[model samples]
Structures are given as structure tokens and as C-alpha cells.
Target: MNKVEMHHTIMAAKARKEMTWDHLSELVRKAPVWLASVCYGMNSASPDVAARICEVLELGEDVAIAMTEFPVKSWEKTVPQDPLIYRLYEVVGVYGPTLKDVIQEKFGDGIMSAIDFSMHVEKIEDPKGDRVLLTLNGKFLPYRSW
Candidate 1:
């Protein structure tokens, strides 16, 4: 089966077994976000990790191999229509430049590396409503003049 098919299988098994990414990651000994991305077909998994996923999901070797294949990280070209995603898009559009300038000023000319990133989602309790907090942590990559 193809990578897309593998992803479908993973999702189906996850639903059938009522498994969470955090649980799967614990079993596979990997970070939840990274493991979730692998299941979503956005990232590649090591052979051992892929095999473990297959075992857990009751998928076959095809899926394990597919998990190991390099992925092309692509998304829709236009702005997202979903409200939550669109709000993120709006935040980036509004504050991206300011963030960049502040970062550059503070840390010199460089960029945060998504390749070396980690993120966590947290829930904060408030009298009004619970708030979703997303924290992104990434390594800083400095520009080098050749």
C-alpha cells in the first residue's frame, strides 16, 4: 500500500483501538508530536519505530516501509479556510514581521529550525474558559557568510 493508504490504516487502527498519539509514542519511545507527524505522513520514521507502529496498529510491512520513506511536506497553497487554522494564519501574517525583527535583533541574523523543533499543547484554566496554549521550541540556526 502507498503512504496515503498507510496513513489511513494508521488512523483507522488508532480509532479502532482508541489509541492516542501520546500512548503510541510511549510504546514506540518517541516524542508524541514526531510520532503523530509520522502517522500523518508528514515525517519519516526509523525502521525500528516504523516496525513498532506496524505491530501496534496491526498493519503490515508495507506500511512500515512506507513510514520509512521520505515525505514531501506540502499543504494547500491558499490560506486555510478552517477557523482555527485560519486564526493561526492570521496571527502569523500580523506578527510574523515583528517576531522576525525582534528575533533578529536579540539573537542576530538567524532563523528557528523546524527540523530541530519541539512543541507542546497545554490547557490553562480560567474563570471564563479554558485556554489552549501552544508552545514551540526550536533550535536557532545562525547564518554564515561564506
Candidate 2:
């Protein structure tokens, strides 16, 4: 975890702080979820979409191109680039428990199942205390939705 990487935290915070649903929507020239959908690579964003998003998000043309032509890997699950996912890591680091609480309240007994999940863990022993270190990451979607 290394405390979830500071640079990672900063970018996610910036995205959450600066990007709004309207802004993201207008950027994609579509619905807000469409931005997520676009980022998720479920669909291709047109040049108009790319231009709008770049302007609103203040993303440079090159990065905008990357998003527009985002590669679609045929894994059963999807993930974004490292920097983007790290941004998500920052969000979770800051709001993890709150999110967990809200999700639990909403879903009731249906926590994010880690089946098909992958995580890395290491054990380190020390005079202070034996440590169990972990980096746990997984794609989250409703289990039944899969």
C-alpha cells in the first residue's frame, strides 16, 4: 500500500474536486456516466467528445488522444491506466470506510465480493510487531451484475 502513494492521492483528489458531473458530461458532450463509460472503453468518444473533454478537464491534447483512442482489453473486467486507477486509490484511501458504510447500508449483506479478486500480500516480522502488508485492488461491480 505504501500509504497509497501521495502522487496518486493528489491526482484523484484533483479530479474529484475539479471535475463535476456537468463538466464531465459537457466535456464528453454526453451524460456524466458517459464519461465513465468512455473512460471504461465501453464505447468510443468522437473527436467532438474528445475536444470538449480536453477543454473542460484541461487535459492536454496528447492525453486527450490517449483517452479517445483508449485500448479495449478483452479481460472479463476492465481497468484504467495506472495513474487513473491510482487516483481511485487515493479516493478510497481518503473515503474508504465512508464508502464501505454507505455501500453496506444500501446493499445489505452484499459487500463487494472478492471472488475473482487478486491481491498481493507480504509478511514482515519485526521486534515491534509482525506485520502483514498488503496491496489489495480489484474491479468493483455488483456480483450479480457479473
- Location of the lowest summed lDDT over 10 successive residues in candidate 1: 1-10
Give all candidates' CA lDDT scores: 0.91, 0.57
Candidate 2 per-residue lDDT over residues 37-106, each given as its tens digit? 4555544567777667656655556545555564444443344458956676677778998978887777
Q: Largest lDDT belongs to which candidate? A: 1
Per-residue error at 60 for model 1, in Å?
A: 1.1
Candidate 1 on 1-146: residue-level lDDT in tens? 66799889899999999998888888888888789989989999989999999898888999999999999998888999999989999999999999999989989999999999998777899999999998989899999999
The pairs that clash in candidate 2 are none
